[model samples]
Target: MSGRTRLRGRFQLFATLLVTLVQLPTVLWLCWLTRTPLPLAVAVPVSFPYLRQLQSPWHTTAPALSTYLALGWWAACAVFDVLMLPAALAVQAGLPRGVTWGVAGAIALVLGTDSVLGRPRLRKRVVHVEGLSPELDGYRIGQLSDVHCGPHAPESRVSSWVARLNALDLDLVTVTGDLITHGSSHVEAVARALGGLRAKDGAFACMGNHDYFTDGEHLVRELERQGVTVLRNRGVVVQRGGARLYVAGVDDTWTSRHDVARALAKRPEGVPTVLLAHDPDLFPEAQARSVELTLSGHTHGGQLGVPGVRRLSLARFVSRWTAGLYRQGRSWLYVNRGAGTTGPPARLGAPAELAVITLRRA
Candidate 1:
């Protein structure tokens, strides 16, 4: 082999060894701190890397490990905190009252402010277009979903998302679903934030599983009030400079309300049709109905991914197109990782995304 090739191989090996070494201490420390046994100890290191592979591996071994780690960590923390509370209280009672109070106040202020200021981060992704038809070449579509706007994510985060969406200079925008959590208050706030989104072709949306759990009708109305067209198994033809395109939106799958046939019935004949479904599972049905492209964002790309393993092992069972661009025969699907988070406020492996898709005549 040439010297260049040899050097490259050596560098790769060195990098791999370096990563393993760096991770080893953290793994050991986590295991020690948690006071977990050997078999359970392996979970901390293993779960972190497994969450990063959401886009590739279809079947992964991380979810089980992740569950183990989550349970283990929660149990450990709960026990430790419970045990420490009395001791801390006892010490506080014995100490000079004012000194203890002052120290406690200072610590609370620092930690509380840090918690409020260091809010959960949202990942930004800009998918570049390469092979697109010149006629619709520069047509950009911004997609956001699973915002779950609630106590965890306040109005400021929603506003930030709106600003980012507006900055994309998109021709059209779509919200795939899960806009808010358990109430209509956050939904209304999100709607107001999304009202700032501007697109030439206009912004459209569909409901997700959470929307049904909350007040779906109210959320839909609020979105409509904010200039968003909520398409529940319906479609509309958008014309730009004489080039016509069909945009279809479907209901959420978890609700068992998705009707692709109804959505496709309104499409104009022989025009390029795109379907916006909340889940990627609609791809097969969309493809069967001759949809050229399908945009979806339900799975948060396994929000926490393991590095070498697949992210969100549960996703493969749910949808074939978990994240990113995919093809089903002649039809194409682009699954966004979503603009916001879900259950946990923390994002370890998979980050949020804003998918910008450009369609072309193939």
Candidate 2:
């Protein structure tokens, strides 16, 4: 490695060490409160990285009971850090201890309930296209995005989601990427489940940043092997009842694979077209290309926001297109709330989504 790279790695290690050390006080407090021993408390943080490595695809070995217990302890410690730190600070600031504790408890309860019970639900929407043919009007398309199939979103859970999607009787199904996160171990099962989607026009998918991160080429091959089309910067013409609807998808923008022109290349003019992009930020480019409707899902609706209020999402701080349908000029964009969670596997206020969007002639 280059000198700069080596130095960066060393700095990262040092930073991790510092952070872990700083959590010592909180860890001790938690251990005391729960009547746990100090030695075990220390092992939680030390074994967290070890447990993660053991669970990774490269390990090829099952984790032991101790590692599993360590993992749970680490998760509990992490949760305490997130939920109790503010309350602890409030107590230090002369706030009523009971009030502060109550606030923290209420917040934890709310987030816990949301994360555990907020299953993905079917959300329906209608989009009016300016020149949509009668033959293609009322066409239904199911969209599944950000289905991060890993430890948090297991194969069985994703398969169930696909089963529900199949029941919708969609003409076409589009998966807007983020198919897998953390590793490629679950790619085959996830691909097989997605392939089971029943639609007249079939299922198609575009890449997401996580897919690129976790072996994009292998994911494409697996999905293709299961008979699901994976679109990478390309367009295809779908015909039904003597009318044509152009469907296209660009590669993930985050990975620098975004090529709107390339995706829409050689498209016949005046055909109603839809673009499936993982990021809603691409909506401007899609609109510029005169694409009728663009489907996206990357923000997960901030993964924490009030229901029915997309603008209130924390993702709004970074992008205006957090979730929901947005219209500009004659083009429209719909951002799915995503079907899975990343990181903590917790979502508050904002629920997971399985969107079924219908197209109509304006």
Candidate 3:
């Protein structure tokens, strides 16, 4: 009868409907792929979210860890549906059953390689920016984003990332956000690992939606304690000799409101500013303020795409600025594919990235 109870009912109904809808494709593929339908395996992933939402007291509000983890498993199985679509098309085109089976096997192999190997490796890249501050020209800013630490990505990987970044000998560093996936029990350990990262002008970060999922402030405090600047809707001037580089950050545009103007208020009109934002959709606003560069990561490049092709992804269904570089007017936005996984432990086409953005004066 209460509004809260009504909302909970609606959410449960919606989740149940979703699970039912997805079941057809998931079940069809399991029978087609494995040649044996395992009822227990199918039910565990497909029904977990729906059941968890219905059973838990916080049905409409906060979700339990098991719920989040179940979502991950469900997401992984979604790929099987995608593969099945193509297989169905092939069958419709009069392909032999034997040929379709071969295709399914190939798909499984690709998925295995990507989830086990490609997604875990730390990929390095260089981005060249035009009109970068000459004082900062050739200056390397290491970027680590979407560190969905906890279950999918652990503290050990975070420590390894820190060692890798320190080895780069970067002049400046920024973590675009999502340092913690859903909670912050090991936030201090992750922060301590990040503390080992050495940069001439120090390391900075912004917040992401996932960070706020659970005790986000705890992670922020730990980061600060470890000497990393948690820039939340604030700006600071970085000096190397007499040259000045403006650095600022705004809270996540999707999770929380992004106050771009508030962040750049104290910044001069054009002082070669670098804004740390979690979502690339904020680029237009940053461009309005003449921000030279913006760094972000949230999409994880959809976590599944054509490996050789790279740019194509389901993530594009939601965001055109899902990953990679884009220029509008004088401002440039670089959306790192992110360093960790969320939802599912698998990443298909998009590999984890460690960006070294070099300021190149043209």
Candidate 4:
């Protein structure tokens, strides 16, 4: 089965148990505290339906507004479950009512603060490579990933993101995929926004799982039409200051279409190389190929990561390489946190970002 299918099965079971155990108890506790039947009726009605709607048909083709609303509603439900599960258990174990509600409320406040105010920002990182050619040193690459440029992804948001990216002069720009959330309808606006990106060597891209959910080939063509290089199991060489750098891109691994060898086969002998991949699952293979660097951005940093601890997201279970920079011997990988939101249109602890990475010869 596909990754989505496996995750869907697990998510459904987790959701069912969460609602049956956690949310239901939270509602009962609120009703008891208020001593009002009205709260009991309103609490369940307002929240439960959204979770139900979001479930099933893992592949969705609904209106953008409704889908956004449903996702937001689901977000609220998820927050409640995460906060109340322990509280509910404590209450059952005869904890004081005040203590139970206080704990739940505190957790809610922390998560709430993150979701509302965690705006997207630029992150500048200096990565040092041992054998980086001096001519290629100081090379800067701007990364934008998981834009999910669909009906729910606004033109204004993308426009501002593009403006910010262009503001940072970069030697190259790489788009790590999920550019179009749905079909070709949103491709034009997304492409228009990214078309503003400026870099000396130009922007390159690779497909993500969401891109292939519909007609992926069309999306690739549209991106190409916008002057963006959509590299699928291919490699290209770009010259910079008398030095040649090899860049390669692979298709999405989630769909079993990624062929690391096919992509690396085109690299010119003895050239330093960088790779653009949508999912980080192929990092091991890239290391085997001795690729100098790899860029990917599918996890969105789990859409909720602990501020101090980067790897504390549900996405960790999916891929050990969730977000941020990772080094395996000589090969290095940096996963972008994404420039757009997908399901809930909200980011909590894990905020969206435009990454600017500078390379230095170590």
TM-score of each prediction:
0.65, 0.73, 0.72, 0.78
Best by TM-score: 4
lDDT of 2 by residue, 72-146 (tens): 444334444576777888899999987887676566545555554567979999999998889998999999999
Error of 1 at 22 (Å): 17
Best by lDDT: 2
| Better candidate number, 2 or 4, judged by lDDT | 2
- List model 1 lDDT by residue over 1-362, tens digit each: 99865765565456445435544543454466457767345544543443432222122234544533432333233223333454458566796645654554454334323322333233333333233335675577778777777755667887787777787688998888888866666878888877777888899988888888777888889889989999999999888775777888999888899999999897877777778898888888888987878888887776545423444534565566666777767778887777666654434334566766765445
**lDDT of each prediction vs. the true structure?**
0.66, 0.79, 0.75, 0.77
TM-score for candidate 3: 0.72
Which of the predicted structures, 1 or 2, would earn the higher lDDT when compared with the native? Answer: 2
Question: Quick one: ranking by lDDT, best first?
Answer: 2, 4, 3, 1
Tens digits of lDDT, candidate 3, 273-303:
8999998888888988788889989888887
Select the stronger candidate by lDDT from 1 and 3.
3
lDDT per residue, candidate 4, 254-337, as tens digits?
A: 789999899989798878888999989899999998998999999888886666577798568768888889999988899888
Question: Quick one: ranking by TM-score, best first?
Answer: 4, 2, 3, 1
Measured on C-alpha atoms, candidate 1 has an lDDT of: 0.66
lDDT of 4 at 127: 78
